[model samples]
Target: MNKSTFNTASAIALAAAALAGPAVAQQATAVEEVIVTAQRSSQNLQQVPLAVTGYSGAFLERSKIEDFNDLRTRTPSLTFEQFAPGQPRYTIRGIGGGGGVAVFVDDVYMGQPSMSSVEFVDLERVEVLRGPQGTLFGRNATGGAIAFFTEKPGSDYRVKAKATVGNYDLKSVSALISGPVSDVLSAKISVIAREHSGYAFNETTGRDIEDETLAAARAALRFRPNDDWDIQLNIDGSTRRGTAPWWDLMIEAPKSAGKSNPEPRRGRNHTDDGYADIDNAGVSLNANWDSPIGTFTSITAFRNTQSHNRANTTGLLVAPLSDVANRRVNFHTLFIQQADQKAEQFSQELRLAADLGDRFKWIGGLYYYQDDGVANRLTDYRFYGFGPTPVDGRYAYASTNETKAFAAFMSGTFALTEQLKLQAGIRWSHDEKDHTTVASGKNFSGFRDGGVSVPGYSAASSADWSAWTPTASINYQVTPDVFVYGTISRGFKSGGFSDGDSEKQSILRPFNPEFVWNYETGARTEWFDRRLRVNATAFYMDYTDLQVSVFTQLAPNLPAVLVSGNAGKAKIKGFELEWNAVPIEGLNLYGNYTRTESEISALISGANNLAGKKIPRAPENKFFMGASLARDFGGMTATGRVDYTYQSDYFSSINNVPSERVLAQENWDAGLTMGPAGGAWSVEVWGKNLANELHVVSISDILGDAFANYAPPRTYGVTLSYRH
Candidate 1:
């Protein structure tokens, strides 16, 4: 993105959040403990022992989170980077997949980033599980896992709704309904719609807009014939439509200029006018049975998504750039292009455990999963102000890949003694990837000069691989509130064909899957009779054959896209602290902080001097703090909370480009919430980026020059939600 667009990233956010409303719908709290079975078992987040984070439906209405990116403010070690235009690659603990993060609903694995859908209304909670989850999850997830739990059928009839309007002509409305159908069955469903007139304008086709409209619904069916068997079925679906283009930088402006760039001739166009439309659907069944020996449970799921769009790659070429010191037009450049992608997949899980008396217990199961799809990219190019020339011309290129994968696994927990538990697991995965590329009628002039492109270009390649992973963990209860645990695990990612210099090695050389050997120990405890809760962990990940994306000026008209294969090692160690304090009744304080040291340990011997270099994009320090006060009146209950998140400086590029960095930035988001003292109805006026702090979330090639993706600026909105 260009500095022009990044400078205004906050304005775009303010305009967007106003129109987007909150992440989900609002309703009365249903479950007291907020149950989540993401690990294939029902467990409270506080009791799970593993590093976990969760947000309930109530939290959404109170905080006013409209998009997944808003989550970055609340969770530690969680990050998101845009993949193409609308899709986002979410990561946890600095361990996200190279291109995207694997997601699951209920128990079904989701593969398509473009069409994936998440709605907050009727949702149970959003769960983020840190570390490699190799033992139970279908595919070998090296980084971590995320799950969205929807509300299921219950015993009572309920109705909920929320409406909001604010900056940039934004409007949002949502509703949900649930009740008992018969003595043995019950159901619940939710619907939401959102709209905004955009905060950006296009220079070519002037329009003040970047609008999004999404409709989502989820239903749960519950049945019970007797006390012995309980079964529930769930279905979810949604479609999102808007002009969410890949807004690249058309101009690099100073931080002072903000989204208010001083450019007028671009015509009927705004930097964010890239257009797209999307749709998605998912279904699953969860059943539980109780017997004398123990309890057995099963979770099955499937999801499908289809997304399409025609994004104007024009921003890449027309972006205006200047030196860091002066806002002078540095160059007049232009290129036009776009890509189309689609993906879909399914998964299932079964868990059975037998309680062998009070002291002995164990559980194990078989897991299987398979995915087949194609990611096809079509690239088209053209020049500005004039027709095609000898040096500049219009062209199209096409590429496709078939991804198929399968895996099976088992794990169990054994009690060694009264206060200690032993956990072990193993898994084997087989993955096949087929890739092909074709470039025709495209003249390559710069390819002859740049060392990165192939001399006499041809378009395709393919490959495949199999992998195995093992893990062990031990938990010792030092006391009632303190526990010490350590785990060592391994995970791998499949290797595929690369179009660029990724082929530096011999063609006969096999593509080695990226591996992560992580070691860690942690503690979870509370002191002063639950007045303070502290969860801390220290971890190190040894990365090998790390898949790295390489960019080069292979084709001036193409903006160079390719990958490179190399063996490199790195160590990422970090400490995280989350705590709560209650010094007095009706008064509470909370704080969370993370400190990490991520660096390059080796860089292919003599190829690069990256050893000891700090990893790009990884911030060294991040902390969030908040305070809440509540006093019970005779007939009503009311409370107010305010929070702020602070992060240190971070690099934007792998090479540690200085000009492209998100410097020490501080963001403060606070909310004033008050309900009918009884907690049945409430209204909240919230301000995010309350200080109007201008900060960048990410920066990439937008036309060129420091293109940045920024956070939303200061804005205040009001929300009124009700439940009965």
Candidate 2:
């Protein structure tokens, strides 16, 4: 950690200790309780018998967690990476990427990576479950699951609105209104708009880059005709327009010949200012019927997304040799890439829950899902020279993939005694996929020569896979304030063909499915009359046929292409410690620490045997600490909060090249709010990354050059909110 970060963290720690010293001597209060649905049923978080994290909507708003990247700083063993604004990738316990982790919104699966950065408008809570959850969640739950629950319409009327202004010309406004339309109907609506100026500058274009504008809206309706039947419907849509993420050229290519420096800067020399545009919309319907025997629930959902992006892949402005002296040219571009993607998915689920007796309870569910996606990409390389004419080479690639999946799952809990319980669950899943690809390239002898078409290829393939995943756990209540559990579970992820590869072999053969066996033990305890709560978990996972993506050349003269294949075996083990304390009334302290170790145990044949390499994006250690205090003075209330987070260094690729390593980082955030006691209006001032730390979040190495994406710099904002 740097000097500024160390000092900021130390100050917060000292302040927390100082407050606790005197507060501990006073009368303590019970910590707040959190309810979650990790097991497909509502239960207290401390009694869930799983490694999970829950965040209330109020807490998220106070912390200013606007997106998934902000949430990763507070959660343990969670890693988030984004090459651009709309495309995001998440990892948990060294397992992620390409269907390894499942994301859900109101019990509806989000199948596309572009949908990962949805707006957190009006939410009841967010839950992050670690380890395997395949038995209950069905397919693509190998790493774990993230579920987001939105607040439902209530009988009473409510209105909430918020506005924020920040540095970098940031502006945001959001509002939500919910009320009862009649005795049997309720409705709710929420909308948000946010915009910000660019953070980076384009030296060549003389314009700002990395700016963003977003707008989203959601509507919901609930109907209750009788005491036993209930129905709800939700619709949401969002649009995002932004410049491409800023990438620092950390290392120059060997062919550059001293034209660029190998240092990180906030300026780029791209000829064109790239752009990203994304549109996403979804709808869901849910119905429930209560009967004497059990409760039956049905959920049907559909989603569609489209995105178009253009970027200067090389991050360089190359001039033709003939115009080197003038330092100016008509076409001063080196390389450019453009991508257009479209995806749509539909899912249906039916579930039943019942209690046979006081000693046993069970739940069963059936699920079906289908999705289709298409991606078209273009790559232009100006190898020989720069001009207004045709370039030296141009490549176009397109792919379409379709998937269908079905699953049935059931789980039961039998209380052997008052203090001991046995839980078991199983799921049978079947998946089918069809993929097609078309690739072609055009080559030119020079800027003035005629173009020649290279050999093109088109191929199609289909594959199917099936898996039976199971889970078993034993739980014992040592006392009313303490609980312990041990569990074993299995997870599976289906396989598919690679895209952007023109080779016939790549399309003819599809990758195999990956599987994991996870073993875990955990404990939850409270002390000092429920004033302090602690939770700890230890887990180990064994993986077989692990799917991995690597960049390789199909031939000596062709450009590199990404290919997906199965690896031999791998292992990952990790432990987490989390604690929350309410030493005295109006004072709260919370923190978590995590340690992870991941390694490849074996490699496929003909490989150079990189068996012990660390998994990509898996940091060794992660720590978070925070304190919040609220005080009332006469007719007004004031709350102050401070938090710190730390993450160890990690590599961005399986190769673990030193140049591609993301360095360790430390961050600090603080916020203060003031309002009238029990009033309808309030104001808050918040700052993130107070230490102004510069750290890389992702890196890509191509052609001996390393490009890095850095986290956002220091930002401060003020918000005004009204509730009635």
Candidate 3:
């Protein structure tokens, strides 16, 4: 069925079911409770003033959220775009891109967008906090924050394992084991591995693209020496090898054309080599002490990563450049390129929490972060000039980027009365970064001295930034089950390098930091004897110094350049509504809707004018609905669930080009489980994108053509899991 027909039918069915649900009540049972740590303390989700979503480990597995992309459809006011494995950019409420959002595991920030794309394992829960989180998370959280809480070792021994096989030679294995090792020590270990053949075929090489192979492991240990002291250590590593997203000539255009054109369902044609590999490792230590006055906690961590990528953009640049230059770009072609990158980081945090009598509660923390990174890129250029002399140039560049940051933060809540409360938070942060770039070009044309000549150049630049952000909120409780609150918060995002061939021309120039002031009001209420819940939030953001990437050609001989510039000012406003209901025992229903609108009011500086343009990737409207039912029959139990998602059209590029626009899409998924309650084994069958819709989720324009990356096709799989 078509999307419109399916949507109409589904809506009618859901409405009917909801209307008839309350009358058929089974054994009375309260809705499941959700706990979250969005405010740096454990609290019931309903008590939090911010717009947040929390999911337990069981929920994650049942929903088949194996990676970050899977999260895009499940959450409201959030979107994800992936250029490749380990390379993802997020847009939250029209405020994201260029590392604007932050992801953390146990309060330790991943530091980079690429590093945050790793697989999750043995997780206790996942929480997504919407809106600015600058008061506590600091820089890079101008949009929002996502936190992954890993499961800790328990005193009881436990083991869980699962394996799966699917089409396209897809294979996966995962296991987790936990137990007490000694009287005072407990440990947990988890590992996951996956391999899959590609889905797209490359006619040029007669091979499949988009294949993936990955493995990851984590080990954790906990020590409780006394009633007042607790310590925990965790170490993890991951390695992956995957073919990068291949650009195809989706829209067949003449070599003389430069503008991008839209073409749906284009065929794949990767004529050149393309690949990516990554290796990452990290270790963390946490300690806590319970004292009479409060609880003191410390966290320290170190991480490292090495990666390499090689791809060909011949059609996008070399071919067009050669055609425009009216020169013979050699048969071997001068377009293949490779980049190698390495990074190392260390961080430490100290925090204290106390309940000061019954009138006030406070939490404070100090944090430090340091990182060092190096990247090297090499390019081959070959084009024959007028005199049989080709510009066979071997160009190489290396860059080093380093950063150091420190911060202090504190938050408190005061009870003014039995029904009124006031909360405030403040943070002071300082950051500094140094960047150095060295570049050289060697022309092997054999016309100018038959030898390599290098006019070597190097440049360095540094920037220091500091910011003080504060947040305040007032919450009122109308009753024991209803809460209303309002808050205003400030956020900041650090800025850095651009894409260019030289330091003076691009990479070394620093852009100003972007900032946002967000105002939000929300309410949480429970109805029908706590069996139904409703939450809503409305927000507005005043954004300034928007960091935008601009493309230009400073000179004919120089390579095309992209620079980070403070280009425009924008305003964003949105509202979210979420509801959950357990009208009858063994049946649960949930749904959410979000509406966001953003506009660029003025263009202060930049290459192109973007006034009156909507921010890219920020869908105007989105909806999600799901239902799950479970029942017992004799000694066996059966459970089933279904979820549907719909998103309005949105642009994928900054220019708001028509060709970069994605049409509205609807996706549906369903699953079933059969087993005894609390049994050691269970069988599950699941299907995703049941309607088999085709839609582009991301696009790249560098290849002289609009190359689109489509969402996954319809997929179904079955699995059997065991636990002891």
Candidate 4:
């Protein structure tokens, strides 16, 4: 995926992406202002000092964002993939993990992969923080964070209801009601139900690849006995049932390419329909105390999640097992996987802040977190049939994993001068995990009558890691509306054992924890009477044993295991530029661009040289822009906006080979909304992938069964919303 330096292809792609984002003329009006708290304090989007992106309730409706996972393509610079398929696999600037991404629900961490099941329905806003977040927050935040703010109790008594219907026979209902329980207390409750027929049909089986339904609810109470003290408690839960298919539809090449050659030129098409269910519940308490010395805050949270899913890969209609050529006789056409997991986490934090003197002010905090979890998976493989007959052999793997973790952290800030400030922080964290695998006792294809005889493997292993990380930052105000800053920080991620000898050990590595040191500089500025603002940052990071995940061929019915290792010298440097301006009444414009350079200086034996190449999932260039106009007529308001995002070609695998074949696609989404202020609500229509262009995303390079995943197709929908 590395742009070929000194080559015409790289130059052309860069030029095209440079102009990818829209360049709009300033305008006026925003769709119900977006609010965010990237700095740990509630504030309007425009007032946040960091690079932040907030989507208001109104915007979410227009974008057809139904669940928490739908936020992927709706936002620029955001991309997600399920390494484990139904999990929250978040990647911002390609910064998440193979284990999944970090999710923050109302400032509390999800803690583990399965815990990401937190639903996004009845939410007030979603904020995406786009870089290392060391100044605030907790957990493995090296890649920044995604915050989902559920509906909260307001100062006024209110009742709101919303509903929508769309294709796939999709229908939804959401409502929120809040009012005073007494003079000193208030409560709010919100709920949502989503039902859809799913987007899958079996041409031969007379079945759909997908069918799913879900419902979720939340209740919260706020007690403000006085201005100096307040308490808030929230309880939420959700349940889902049916198959949520993983549709990575591929366009197979003409039969001429030959089934023997599963290459880019000769394609083999295969996909799967799977089922999943999830039940989740959580409770949180937030209490604040205002003292003359400073402000004291206490937060305690507990959550539990149970999830299950079943799916098959590389399964297609029964076909010839022989006459397949080099790859024909040994490959598998149908394989199934089932996973069940339970996760729970509890956390508490106590902090104090105050303005000590004119030259010095500080904030300090004590934090604690614990995680306990278990995950079990079973996989079964069916090989090229002996003319459509099912056989029994040695092929099935079942594995279980147990995990635990704990951490403590604290930090403070000091104003060195009227125009200068400095901050420092440190954290100590520990994690432990154990894994075991047993033979599923299922027969294989060649051994018995049914799929038979793969010997079950019984093995167990455990690993633990501890690390101390420190962070420092300095900021200087250069002008009334301009500031410059620099930061030096460290990031750590623990590794697990991967004993290729066993199924349970094959998927994960028992390697030591990886650490990274980062140095950064950035600037924030505003000019033209606050009519325009810009923010940008760049950084260089050094890695020692930076852990990475790569696919490794395993046993029959079992997909390639995800391997971990300390890949040598790697570096990532990127810069982001965003501009916001309003040149005149009724006109608003925004544009942003991100350019990243990534390289792997070395590779393990038998692995291709990825040195000087763009890291997998790291796009060399990304751009976004939007312009909207607002007009008021007879007390009603109308608005229109168009946004575009362009990404340069990227590699989907670890190999840096030139002919792997990934595409560069530019997508645009536009919307229109009209409504009266404080009235019923608004009506909107929106479209994504407006050009209806085809794009290639990830591709498997395993030699015998290669395939490519495509991006979403052109989709358009209409929405209507009410305020109360």
Query: What's model 2's TM-score?
Result: 0.91
Q: Model 2 over residues 1-724: C-alpha lDDT tens digits?
A: 1234323332332232221111011122677678999998899888988899999887788778888878899998999987766667788987888868889998898999887667887988999999988898966889989899988897987676777889988877777778899999999887777778887777767877778887777889999988998899999988888887667667666543314434354554667788988889999999999989899999999999998888775566554334466574433335677889999999999999999999999999999999999999887776433234534678787899999999999999999999999999999999999999887775222111112233777778899999999999999999998999999999999988887655556666898999999999999999998889999999999999988876554434333456678777999998999999998898989999999999988864223465888888889999999998888888788889999999999988776777678889899999998887777667999999999887776787665567776777888999887766
**lDDT tens digits, residues 1-724, model 1?**
1223322322332332232222322222221234566446676555554666677765655556566766766777776666343466666666554532467665666766664456666665777777677666636466777777666667876676776666755565566667789988888766666655554456545665355665566778889767877898888777766664434453453432223235321233234355566677878888878877667777776766666665544344345445577644433334334455555555656667776766555566655454544444433443332223423544333445566666666666677887798877777777777655544444433332234554333444556677778888888888887877888887776665553231223222335677788788888777777677777888888888765553444444434443455448877889778777776676667778888778777764233465776666578898888776665567455567788888788766555545556688787777666665545566767777778775665665522445544444566677676666
Q: Best by lDDT, which number? A: 2
Per-model C-alpha lDDT, please? Answer: 0.61, 0.81, 0.75, 0.62
lDDT of 4 by residue, 1-724 (tens): 1112112222322232222222222234322345676655556554444556787765565455655434664444566655333465566665666432467887677876666765555677888876555446646666667888876685776665555565666555666667788988999877766666644454434565455576677889999999998889999887777663433324333331224322221123234456677778899998889888888888899998888887654333434445446564443345566778777888887777777777665566767776666666665655543445544333444555565666666666678788788877777777777866554455342222122333445667777878887888888888877888887877776666552333333443366666667677778777777777777777776666655666654455333544566667677777777777777777777777877777877756224454665557677787777777777778677778787767777766566544344667787878887777435666777776789666554555432454443444565666655544
- List residue ranges in candidate 4 displaced over 4 A: 1-36, 39-70, 74-77, 83-85, 117-119, 242-272, 319-332, 385-402, 439-454, 497-509, 554-560, 605-613, 656-662, 693-699, 708-712
Q: Pick the winner on lDDT between candidates 1 and 4.
A: 4
In angstroms, what RMSD does candidate 1 have relative to the true structure?
A: 7.0
Measured with C-alpha atoms, the lDDT of residue 570 in candidate 4 is: 70
- Of candidates 4 and 3, the better by lDDT: 3
Cα error, candidate 1, residue 672 (Å): 1.7
lDDT of 2 at 210: 78
TM-scores for candidates 1 onward, in order: 0.84, 0.91, 0.87, 0.83
Q: What's each prediction's clash count? A: 28, 0, 1, 40
